[model samples]
Target: TVIRDEVGLSLDKADKAVLGTAAKVVLTKDATTIVGDGSTQEAVNKRVAQIRNLIE
Candidate 1:
């Protein structure tokens, strides 16, 4: 269940099961920031490589 909103304050009411965990979260009218716990470093590196390949 992907929740889409300009600001994610609505997540306050969302069920815990559908919500994700992050080291920190900050939301504002213009942006949302999620700081991860770095457990997905390999996946992030792979995606970054894929993006670089695409841009090259």
Candidate 2:
């Protein structure tokens, strides 16, 4: 979907059903590569921001 692309996640498995039934948190490699960044938090935040942007 358009939202996925914005965050630079892989579209390799875009099918919603295949995406997983539980909550999805996508961690983009680019966000993780930021110097001195907290990888886990950065990933979670990026995913949350992406979803929030869609609804807002």
Q: Give me the candidate number with maximum lDDT.
A: 1
Model 1 alpha-carbon drift over 4 Å, by segment:
4-14, 37-56
Clashing pairs in 2: none
Q: Of the candidates shown, which would achieve the greatest TM-score relative to the real structure?
A: 1
Against the true structure, what is each candidate's TM-score?
A: 0.40, 0.33
- lDDT over C-alpha atoms for residue 56 of model 1: 90
Across residues 2-41, which tens digit of lDDT does each residue of candidate 2 receive? 4365677667847775343433345696542223323478
lDDT of 1 by residue, 1-56 (tens): 34546446466667876675778999999977678846488976785687577559
State candidate 2's TM-score. Answer: 0.33
Assess candidate 2 and give its lDDT.
Answer: 0.56
